[model samples]
Target: MEQVVNMGFISIIPSLLAIALAFATRNTVVSLGFACILGTFLAGQGIMGFPTLIKTSLGTTSFAWVMLLNTFIAILVAFFQKTGAIQGFSQYIQNKNLSRRAVQLLAWLLGMFVYFSDSFSPLFVGTTMRSISDKARVSREKLSYIADSGAAPVSVLVPITGWAAYLSGLAVGIGAIVTQEDAMKLFIKAVPFNFYALITVIFVGLISGGIIKDFGPMKKAEDRAIKEGKVLRDGADPLIGKELTEMEAYPGIQQRVFLNFILPVIMIMTIAIGTYIKLKSAKTMEAFLFVMIFMGISMFIQGIPFKEIMHTMTDGVKGAVPAIMILALAYSINSLSKQMGTANYIISISEGFLSPQLLPAIIFLIASVMAFATGTSWGTFAICMPIALPLAFSFTGGEATTLVVACFAAVAGGGVFGDHCSPLSDTTILASTGSAADHIDHVKTQLPYALICGGMALAAYLIIGFTSI
Candidate 1:
């Protein structure tokens, strides 16, 4: 194990291998599986480490929480389809005859409004806006980009979200942020300097508003949709299977169709927001569970039989299989990354690059690369904050300078760049499933836009660093 730790370049092989295979083959499961196996072997474990690693990775309470949440959201999507609620809502929006720009704008707004949870925001907005966007001739790639732009980027912008809480908790005892309140204040102070999140969000809005035109792979998808009227590309494999995407409305389900959709959403926002305000930690899963319970009872009372309800739930679970399989492999590889001390190796190699005038930009670049390779923004935040904050303090002689705040925001925003674009990011996967877009296509189309924003953010961080001196 020590030998593995000392093997600096070896730590990154698995993640890099995953990235290369994913792009070359366009198969997430195969890419992730091979990376997991290679990573396990590299960590000094034999072939038997594969199963053991899977058990340890997926056995965590965190993985269970994500698994159930993904399943529940899928089930809710199934129920929405089965009851014709989603259709009714889409028809209602389409009946207004909103233009494509307006429809995209609406989706962007929906994503921003669901600012409480990164996990919830993209999926909810994607599911809630997919049909309407399709009817407006918007490509699924565009929809995924909008959904993703508003996810981790938006979550980190707001103060009450789980992202904020986790970040603030990490910041505690660092520099001037000794208390939770102090950490929160520091987070807020860093918000405006969080250049990537700000730019990414604004870019989405501008694109949606028709102030900016589509470019890169996204433009190709949009062109295919506009000229051919194909919302998804021909032969694209969507993460959400036809089981839920094509699920028919249950027989004898007729009345209050729109209400069926609205009530549960209301319940989720109410409970999740309410708990976060009162309890600091957001009970996001509980909110989804309550919505499910309400939907089950409400649908039953709406004259759908109990057997049909159970059957719809079953179909929902089945539809979750494709996404879950990919996610399981993703988790396994991420676990291997942790065991190999991949992020630590990154930090170690980055040590020589830190200086006051260049620190902010360098930190942002390092965080971005680490998050991209590992596919987890929060993991980057967790590892980077402890090091970045202490470095910022030492560089500033413990005075709260512009450099310190800029560094803080650099890590926050840079990590989100990975979440927005990386194939292995959960938010990216959720965006695909929610929009029923091909996962690889989503990654491909969104990558250019994310990189543009990342480039702008990097420039801004550089300015902040030089000017702060």
Candidate 2:
């Protein structure tokens, strides 16, 4: 055990070094790839040669799950887009004669709902809502902020998502550390305490309602937009100007666009409710089937030819390939960390910090840090479960709920926190890309909101930890 742990810790050195290098150089893809390679090398060690390591590193269940999830999401997105659903949604928002605040609120709700449907929350929500947000004259920063706020955080809150299921499975594997059931229960409790996610929702409400004025760079951008009667920045809504041109030349496609907009949503909601009530144990496959069915229904309703739907599905899957590659690489790195005992090393470090009054806070802090570092809350939970769960059992004196909630909250909140900021994180990239906002701009503008939420979450953890009742 000691040897495995030592080797595991040693193996992480390359990844750590690579991340530092990436940050220093500001090369996102290179930095991520280097980290992934380092992880694979450390995992392979001597048991497998470089070729085997490379193959297995990219061939894990985590990688497979990404492919499956992305394929489904891409298909659904494409179906909606090709059928003109997105245009329809945008039209409805514009035609409603609603206030900008109302549009922002609706954007927030859409963001939350999209988070539940796919891990690609940023792309799903941003792509669908960009047109609407633009029409409302909401700044791209605010749109990205709303999308980022709800994306991963909401996923962490839900138990039936890819994020939740993945983390729960990880929790179950750590010898007697934590059970899948216990891990999930903890996640549920932590949802309320997740200050970052909660604060994000609040921030949107406040900002949209004019209770909070834009400030700093965001303020400048908004001012420029209002004064110039247009966005002054080059990075403003990458998709907007381009799509407007296309829609103008092809006005016929815009005619029944609203129907396309409503179809995918109705389908996804029905599936979400069905999965929640009937197939409680549904996995990625169940979700895929549900989404596919809805797309089919959409085709029939929209009078889209079957061949056209199939073609769109193919195109959607193609678009998802890049994200799939990134996800696969990420999963491979995580799996390698597990096999190399890096996870156990993490657990070992966390074990010494355990205490009764501080246990929940510790869980929150530790899980958040680990999730942020690893870019996977589920990975963080998997690593901590073996360590924290058993400690919780031994130290809680019987307040399992407290321990469970703390652990769950830490993992869920931390995962969202990490994914929110990580340069290499899929959601971060997708949000920017989908919104046609520069990736760095999106990251920079939206980070404060995430940090604010993180602060609130920390306070909530302390409150939950200290105040009995």
Candidate 3:
């Protein structure tokens, strides 16, 4: 059994500090790092706790895998940009002569299609559509919001994606789910109750279709783009960086944008789904690896020198260093949360207050706060599922399966809600980077919509909780 720290209310300090600092500073890495250091110190390891923190963080296999996956994604995006594939894709979209609303809808549709991995979906869709959206007078902020809305939300809704695989494993590990097959069934049943994700996706479609008018900062961004003919606000610093912004396609090759762009994307989708079916698990990293290899080979065949390809790859990795640092710190804080017994403390305190009619709504709210602070939906799942599943089992007397499913949905939906709104989230960062929007701008413009969906989800959970009871 895992040891629980007896720090009482102090256990929540790290997460609270992290969230407060992130909002105040708009620097996720610094905020998470400081919180991690403070948490380590409070764990009674003294000043030397910093070294132990780094070692523990680096020692985690998931951290390394996430690092590699993010780096590979950056490299693939760089390759696409360098080889003119992304430009070609943009040109193809431009040739369609679609109106602004149609163009935004197209980007939304593209995001939906790339649902196998949340990380890949935003990067692929945002990069491919950024120029097109700009041409159609769509704000970079709106583009980013569209990209992000389709990412984690879509992945969690789909059962074949990496999110589902990880979530199913967590369910099984908690012992509430008896088998992988049963876990998947439970996940599928809960999908309809994932109100935040469902509503977010639908809301994106409504916004793109002009049915839902923009409000808050998003409205200002859209007005700036359309009225002033500026895709970005004046003085906005886009997250694409100078290096990637200035990268040019290789010389002396006819840019067959359609063939170059579509082929690799198709291959990625095929490998992701094919491998999942064959292996009974999603091979997200392996899919990305193979896609990178295929992209390199294709570039080489197109007369781009191997050295140039390698340079682009290196540049891509370098560009992703900032995001990687943030992710590393986020992971470190999650580890600290585990050691500090943050989730346990929260659960223990809430146990006395939980009732069947309020359990789902309460769980959703707590999971949302935890994920928002940590900037990791998976980490929230890891923390919440163990407590939630067993409590759900007890609350329902192991007979109210639908109520249990509703609670599961609340947790999953809440995680996505928090992740969608957090500037510290990896997918949120990728959406901004891929769309060439300012990171804070992305966070600011997207938050209102996320909050709206989150509120609706919370209310839905309450209704479901009451109905089930």
- Candidate ordering by lDDT (highest first): 1, 3, 2
What alpha-carbon RMSD in Å does predicted model 3 have with respect to the real structure?
Answer: 2.2
Quote the lDDT for 439 in model 1: 88
Quote each prediction's TM-score: 0.97, 0.78, 0.93
Q: In model 1, where do residues sit more than 4 Å from their true spots? A: 1-6, 255-258
Candidate 1 has its poorest 10 consecutive residues by lDDT at 1-10
lDDT, candidate 3, 1-469, per-residue tens: 9566747677778878877886677666677888888988888879988778888887888888878887888888788789887788788778889999999899899899999888888887788888899889999999999999989999999988778878878888444588888788889999999999999999999999999999999999999999999998887767665556667888867777656677877888898888888886667788789989988898888888999989999888887777677777767777777777776676677767788889899999888887776678888898887778888888767753878898888889988998888776888988987888887789989999999999999999999988987
Which is superior by lDDT, 2 or 3? 3
Q: Per-model C-alpha lDDT, please?
A: 0.88, 0.61, 0.84
**Alpha carbon lDDT of residue 419, candidate 3?**
82
- Where does candidate 2 stray beyond 4 Å? 1-4, 7-27, 38-54, 118-120, 137-141, 158-191, 215-254, 257-259, 283-311, 339-341, 350-352, 401-404, 466-469
Q: Candidate 3 lDDT (Cα, whole model)?
A: 0.84
List, residue by residue over 354-462, the lDDT tens digit for candidate 1.
Answer: 8988899888988898899888899899889988889999988897788888999988988898667679888899899889899899999999888999999999988
**Residue 139 lDDT in candidate 3:** 97
